[model samples]
Target: MKFVNSLLGLSLLLAASSQAHALSRNAGQTNQSAQQESPDSPRPILLNYTLLKTIDLATLSQNLASFGIKARNGVSIYKVSYATESLDDTSLNASGIIIIPDTKAAVFPWVSIQHGTIIAKAEAPSVAPFEGLAEASQGFVAVAADYIGYGDSAALPHPYIIAKGYQKPLVDLLRAARELANQKDFDLGPLFLKGYSEGGYATLALQKALETDYSTEFSIVASAPSAGPYNVELTGVLNVEKPVVNPVNLPFVVLAYNYWLADGQLALNDIFLPAVATVEDALSGAYNSDQVFAILPSTASGLFQSAFVADFTSDQPTLPTSRDLRALLRTQTLLDGWIPKAPTRFYHCIDDNEIPVAVTEQAVATFKAAGAPSISSVLIPSPTTGQPYLHGNCPAIFSPLQWFGEILSGKAAQ
Candidate 1:
């Protein structure tokens, strides 16, 4: 525990700062008991699981290509509710989808998918219930957490980049998923985690947390976090000053971070110019992903004040507020200086225009240097020419392919 704390000192600092700021912002909005149940709260436990829907292999295969169904498999989607602490350490109810195989197979490892950023609550794994079915068709008990602010917990603000905030619900849902599988006579095995984009960040974040804090309670045989803004400082923070092909990323990151760290009280004026700052509500979950992007300007520089962009681009931020924002973004990073206890594989495309390939390449190098036992990185090549594609184009589409390929190769479960 001490070692985990030592490695995550900066992350813990961010959580602490969030709590302190939250107390000041939300004192009247929440109860004292709600804020008290946090890091010191009881260890997470499975509350219950409610079956939502079921799907067969024929139906699953119709949607996904390159997924081979070897057995007469069926999937049961369950709305898994569990107890977990909120970003500010308050006790809150959360939910996820537990997609378990209905096959009579003896046992198999768990494959959990952390989905990308979503606005509408229904798009979450629990409501959509079809997100991880392709993986479940392979006889793995697939689980996908709705994170904090989706599904049953939609009223609370989503802690977009908070790693620990999502990790707790994932851990608890796995327990509930396994229990539900047991009730249905499906055996279980080792665990594997995979996700792309924001989900990728979460997959890696949970892997690190499970390896350290929950080492005794859970384990992932392998993990693949592809093209996430894992290097939050560079990809998420500093790069906001540069001209970005996608303008929405900067405001989305800033808005979400302020919502969590500042108790939804942080002024948009501090981070954005009048154009972007004035439309803060639209940036929230009220609008869909595409709608939010359309609302913001097309260029990153257009989103912020000209002087702030000048300061950021010159690598000399004079504004005191930008430094604090930068620090908050830094806390969102994963796998840079941490050591892993399990064999891990990183997947990224060389031409990934969203998150830089350099981030993934450099992290793999640093993890090896930090003495991770077994670590490897794979490139998800283009579908036709077998070369890397742009960040969002290729890697976003290849997450499940990489996950299923690993399963076929017996990388995580043998």
Candidate 2:
């Protein structure tokens, strides 16, 4: 996890260019003045390329303000529309909000963002605490996909982990950002991907797909995936007894099973029992986070002998039981499949009760073994004293200042 001093080279380039352009322009002006024989006759001196290219910071700030973001101390914050190609047969007419810096028009860089589960558009404004947008405004073009059914679109059963469906939204969003950059006033630069919680899983999926499918169009500068369950089955086992576990995660397993099973990979009947089926039906309509958590266990318990114990048994033939499931899920599928084509920064709080820190730590190990360009894992302090009470403080844990400085300075590993 070493960050190279590449920003030094960039700084030198900017300084040298400015000095050379200034000297060249001054010399040309002096020659033009001398050529004017008459005091009344004046010749126009040609300006240097650097002067022509110079950006008026004040003007830029004014333009950025129109987009509901403020620029201060050389950083511009703004939200703009970014078009994305739809994967579900609908041609065109799809877009999302991309928060980026006004200065990125000069040095374009890419940053892909993924949101967590059950949270949609209105929820997003609260989720990351505006850090994602700030990241973009600081110097990166940060793109966040509303995941097909969240933002301005229909809220049908969100296909949680159906790989093709999930990845398409993200990839299309990235494509949209690139397309926007090609416009007269945009600068699309090198790309990076970041996500938290369920988004971590989506980010990994996009990274894998990009390396395998879209390498030519996009290059991954770095990726930060935090607190995602790479292994679906393992997640189920880990949450069996945890009171915080809810139906929000249930859809993911169902979706995964539906996807794989539809591909003839596994039979649903063989993997799940009648009780699990009833539980799934009851939990499907649960909307907000509170309802999902409050009703899931009771509904599931009514269907099965015990909501936690009955669903996972040692005798299950095809699908692994709770014990074996934990081992299987603990394995990092996302890290196992994708070769890190760029640097990666993985962060997870040691006190994360929802997604176990052990899972994230394992992922870090997996990426390291794969010879990832840069894999940095940060362990933030626990907010609680005991019993692991603190929740929903990821933004504070992974400070925006540190994240932005690392990426903007090109000190990010991978």
Candidate 3:
């Protein structure tokens, strides 16, 4: 027993020493590169996964100062990556925040966060609105994926409707977290999934894919998805008259179809005017959400007059006949016959002006009808008196945390 114990200790010591050496080498190389660059045109400070873990709040604040990522009291950030197999072409590159407890024992449960639509690095923080739940209440590690076209890789187009494009990043990110946990110093127990709006849809689709595709590698403890368009076709139909949903989401959906369908059958000329032709180039290369939204109104107006509308409307007969056919073609859908294999807690506000709450209700009913295990949906009542929360706010989305806590504590309905 003593010999075996000594051997294990030696192995741990070797691992720790190797990790420290690698960190030192990387830091030295970075410093050397910085020195070679001109003082006026210095290279951006890049934080790696391992170096980020070694930093405390104070050190993190100092490091982020250079990058303009303000490190507030409760906001904790870290960098990470994962190898994924779900992408159609190139490997997915994912990077984002990680909030976990200071102590080892406290780190067990994990939550993977997905952000909303067209949001890029500038608005990336929005992806972690309820970060407190992961860092404080749940004692879990919360990881947010920046998706393929955001933050680190800003040149690629955001794949809005292409499920595989998003799925690769999500799956790879979760795998990265698990890989991090397996390290000698890291410890992550079970994991739960959560997201809002487009993120919500991502969470559900990821959960479904994990169960059916990557079940051997990942086990989801629970999931909470809010205001996601689980059924893409239905969402496009409902949003045409609403305008808020269709126009805002059209570019992303069209981009996804263009990338995923592989035929290059979808064209900007079909939907947008010559003036808006450059819009796709701008959007595809955007590094922030503000840029995406800035181009929406003009882009939408141009699409209204295109032949693409007629073809799209003709393709999706279920969409309201009165709505423009082009908008319907750009709508979201679930690619027939996809379902989740885990218990999921669905939440939505009854008065949500953005994505309709009815969409959430429909998803819940669909999951239940399909005999999903331990599925529950909660409709948060409109603000009563003192409290008022808008769409995608934290407090309004508390039920998901509660459900996740229940699952972590082994109390979730099976």
Candidate 4:
């Protein structure tokens, strides 16, 4: 198979938006029927893998304290390109990063990582991977998808919260990464999943997609999705409209989603005010997530129309426009609790201001209600003050290492 030579775009390092301070970080479908893939769906095929960088053991150990990632020896990082169909079935190339521990182990335990929300194409795994890259140091083959709009496919519109956002590229990347690992003479063993924020939501989506649609093809030994807005309809869309949400998510989700899925079907005015509607196109990738906040109003009241904002604050959404948003939210919620074949744990910080911890709690409760005893949760307290950890700080705190290390350690032993 042919491949792109320069993997993970070395230039992506400078444009990596995930570096805007640590701490960070989708829902769609009925949680089951939504995963049924057409037998003729685009099968993921590995096109190529390009060597990016080598993380030596000493370098890994030196950075261990700052990032909490510990490495035994050196590791090889590769930029990968694979064939995947777009939302409408147009063939497209997706990019991701794959890291292999430079060890002599006969079999490699693998983990697939999903990145949190990023607006710039440079913010992807090949270029940025941000926290997802941390897992690479932990003596495993760590993989992450750039999704559709980043990396090689940067020109494409980022689908944001859509189901296929994670389902398609993530699975395809996992399969392609496995193929590359095999070709390179690495044995594959246990597979696990971990992600936070947008990555967290996508993590759940990927887990369910694999379990429900590709059960015969793959299995996750365990999964941990932290601080994702699982209840999208209520906690995300509905909650963000309350006028206090960080403000950027409203325009980011509302505009990008309609652009990718309902661009022609819904008018800009249908979703935002005339001011916002006129500039909705800018929300696409023309601006990075941070840029979106700068260009758009910083407060929900300033960003949305008065009527729509009023409706969101009311007892129940009554306006046709308000109802339309709710419908969209229902299409993406993850709180339905699809049972996982393996042990799954949800994580969140109680002090999180971005995504309420209640959403994770709700997901755990739903799983328990469905008799999924293997499903549980862990609340990571603010390590410093022992108080609540807000959004941005959590990513730095979680640091992508040891977050899953202890739990996965136990599972690996069993």
lDDT per residue as tens, model 3, 120-227: 434343232223323332356777776766655545555665566677677767765665555525777777888778888888878877887889988887788887
The most accurate candidate by TM-score is: 4
Q: lDDT value for candidate 4?
A: 0.68
Writing each residue's lDDT as its tens digit, candidate 1 over 1-414 gives 232223234223323443454456455542212112358776435566555555567755553433233434777666667777787778887888777777777787678888776765645666555557657777777888988888779887777777877787787777767766666666778788888778888888889888878888886777777777777877754366447646556666677787777666555676576554456666556776557677766666667776666655556566766766667777777855579777777788876767777788878888888898888888766667644477545534345445556665777441
C-alpha lDDT score of every prediction, in listed order? 0.68, 0.52, 0.57, 0.68
Ranking by TM-score: 4, 1, 3, 2
Q: What is the model-wide C-alpha lDDT for candidate 3?
A: 0.57
Root-mean-square deviation (CA) per prediction:
11.1, 15.3, 12.2, 9.1
Score candidate 2 by TM-score against the native: 0.65
Query: Which residue pairs in model 2 clash with each other?
Result: 101-136, 101-137, 108-189, 109-189, 110-190, 234-329, 343-414
At residue 403, candidate 4 shows an lDDT of: 44
The TM-score values for the models, in the order shown, are 0.81, 0.65, 0.71, 0.83
- Order of quality (lDDT): 4, 1, 3, 2
Assess the local accuracy of residue 104 in candidate 1 as a C-alpha lDDT between 0 and 100: 70
Clashes of 2: 7
| Residue 361 miss distance in model 2 (angstroms) | 1.7
Report the error of model 3 at residue 268, Å: 2.6
Question: What is residue 394's positional error in candidate 2, in angstroms?
Answer: 2.8
What's the lDDT for residue 377 in model 4?
76
Tens-digit lDDT string for candidate 4 (1-414)? 001112123235412432321122102221111122357974537776666566578865664544444667777666788888788878888888888888867887788887777766655677664444456666668888888888889887777777777687788888887788777777778787888788888888988899889999997777878788777766755455555656555556676567665665544464465376445654655566556666666566666677777775566788877766767877887756477667787878877877878888888888778887478777767766543467665642243345456655673321
